[model samples]
Target: MRTVFKNFLVLAVMLGTFTSFANEMLEVTPTFNYVTKGNHISVSDAFGEVIYSGEINYSGNLTTLFDFTQLKNGKYDVEVTNGFRIDISTIEVKNNIVFVTDANRKTIFKPVVRNENNSVLISKLALDGEKMDVELFYEGELIYTETIDGEDVLNRVYKLDKTLKGSYTTVIKSNDRVFVKNFRI
Candidate 1:
């Protein structure tokens, strides 16, 4: 019995160490639209000047809302660090659209839509040589779905239906990551 207890204690300590290490690898989501407010992440401008920094208040699951309303249209570096592990991303705001990328310089799926000339423009970026599954829903009905086999840092643009009104939801599945964005037109 004593030997079994000792082995159990060692196993518990090993599991605890692994959990702590995993928690140190930071995961961040930078907000682009005005749908949500309040900042739960840190951001720095291209010049490495800290623009926003604060601690995120935890409620239940990990969810963060970043306010980018005050920032002018420009490129910024956003970083999230826990202990010694750090993850940095670059974000660009143009017109009213925002683009975000990961540390490996791969664009993360954060699509934006805009109305122009009686048409809706939808744009997003994907990594080279990756297969992306895109599903777009208008209101609660699925309007479009496609699987794109990307080639060389793709900048994908889809001219949505001009008459498309009401709520729009886009879901992108790439590798093991899933990104969802919603907009009202």
Candidate 2:
């Protein structure tokens, strides 16, 4: 009788363990819907073509659904952009099946560019130790280049030459992304 009781207890524990593991695995299953704290979201292809774009006008945990079935069998990127950072996730589609996981997500900080009068101020939060490249161009000619890193926040200010000025362009590059700002002095 004791042997039978022990076997039943062991079987019950095994079943409970299996159930817990299965529940954890299903937590990340792709339901094509999720709650986001972002304002704008977009889905793009591998060739840098935007497939779908939407804006979240309301606040709070709003659930959004993206239909991946309309897409072809390939890999795609979904980007959610707030004011300061962009969250990216790569989803794969195979044989009309969509796969997504929280492990395949990344965030990129965006540079803030402001042009006031003749002074240009650029600021970025350096989180992932990625080097930022600041380039200055005058009349389509690259004149200055500066690479910045090793700080919590990267801030740069350039006061343009008030005399020699027709058109000026400031290009900020970081984390394989580029931002261009143009101004006239």
Candidate 3:
């Protein structure tokens, strides 16, 4: 009876440890839909090749840097998974901008600027209750700034100044995070 009780106690402890590890939630911050450096993350290309992987070292806000500055622009799958739960984000990097979405192409935040009929069109979409500050800088000078309020889904389109002939930088701030993209006219 003593041996049986000891075995049972050991089993209970093992099960408890397994359960605790399995229940750990994997959180990707600055938006789970998009991944940059400083997030505990693993990135794979479309061919299932692991391009980048890193573990979070900091305690607060999941700030761990994973460098992708030398990578070529393309679609990649980012995985932030614990032992039990797996979260994947599909992202495309183009023109210094990272466009991120879920498996179903549901974007968390999407921003696009394109030339339309000799004019530049700037469009952005954000999730519900998300506040965004969009700023356009021309030649290092602030050209325009727009603050978007939180709504169920926020969408905005602005016509950019086509006459500003040079490289422009768009800075987007949302949810206490900032994203910068540079484009040329």
Name the top lDDT candidate.
2
What is the full ranking by lDDT, best candidate first? Answer: 2, 3, 1
Per-residue CA lDDT of model 3 for 47-98, tens digit only, reads 9899877775543422224444445788887766443234566777776566
**After superposing candidate 3, which stretches have Cα over 4 Å from the reference?**
1-107
**lDDT tens digits, residue span 68-139, model 1:** 645789988775544322345677877766666454332344445555553445555544456877787889
Off by over 4 Å in 1: 1-124
Where is model 2 poorest over a 10-residue stretch in terms of lDDT?
A: 26-35
User: Residue 5 of model 3: what lDDT?
Assistant: 100
The top-ranked prediction according to TM-score is 2
Model 2 agreement with the true structure over 47-67: per-residue lDDT tens digits: 989998888655443222555
Candidate 1 lDDT at 136 equals 78
On the 0 to 100 scale, the lDDT of residue 79 in model 2 is 82
Model 2: residues with Cα > 4 Å off, grouped in runs: 1-40, 45-50, 53-64, 72-74, 94-98
**lDDT of the candidates, in the order given:** 0.61, 0.79, 0.64
